[model samples]
Target: MSRTESVDKGHGRIEVRQYRLSTDIDWLRELHPEWKNLGSIVAIDSERLIGDTTT
Candidate 1:
């Protein structure tokens, strides 16, 4: 299942959208070193998140 989530900072700051991946992300490591952290994913679900632009 695919999910989207948003990360919020304080003071109406920049917003971050987060998308949850259902499948194992190990295959993504080759493309994104950040994917290495995929193994730490403990839970995930379908979510959609929206945030403000950072400026």
Candidate 2:
């Protein structure tokens, strides 16, 4: 498990961002050969801090 975080203040809004990923699937390419040489896929999940949200 690994993670990093940051906080940004702008446009009268405060944003706290946390990012995470894994070393849990090193055998990804071996299992899925069709996706040759790909180290990682960018998967992002985002939401509104104060309003509604979506993934």
Candidate 3:
């Protein structure tokens, strides 16, 4: 598993993003053999704050 994060401030807002990746999908491939060439999995999470509100 690997992870990366980034933060940016602009236009009166602060934005944050997190990224994750994994190439350990042997179990998933075994469970779903039909998913040919299955290799890695990725996910991302993001957040933004503007003034006193966050979303």
Worst 10 residues of 3 by lDDT: 30-39
lDDT per residue (tens digit) for residues 1-55 in model 3: 9999999999999999999999999998999999769889999999999999999
Which sections of candidate 2 miss by over 4 Å? 26-31, 41-55
Q: Write the per-residue lDDT of candidate 1 for residues 6-48, one digit (tens) a residue.
A: 6666664545565655556566677888666665343433332
TM-score for candidate 2, please give it.
0.52
The Cα local distance difference test for each model comes to: 0.54, 0.60, 0.96
Error of 1 at 10 (Å): 0.8
The predicted structure with the larger TM-score, 1 or 3, is: 3
Question: Model 3 off-target regions past 4 Å?
Answer: none
Predicted candidate 2 versus true structure: per-residue lDDT over 1-55, tens digit per residue: 6677776657555567677766566578779988775756443344335334322
Cα lDDT for residue 42, candidate 2: 43
Q: How far in Å is the alpha carbon of 42 misplaced in model 2?
A: 5.1
**Deviation in Å, model 2, residue 22 alpha carbon:** 1.4
Q: What TM-score against the true fold does each predicted structure earn?
A: 0.28, 0.52, 0.87
Clashes of each: 3, 0, 0
Instruction: List clashing residue pairs in candidate 2.
Output: none
The candidate scoring highest on lDDT is 3
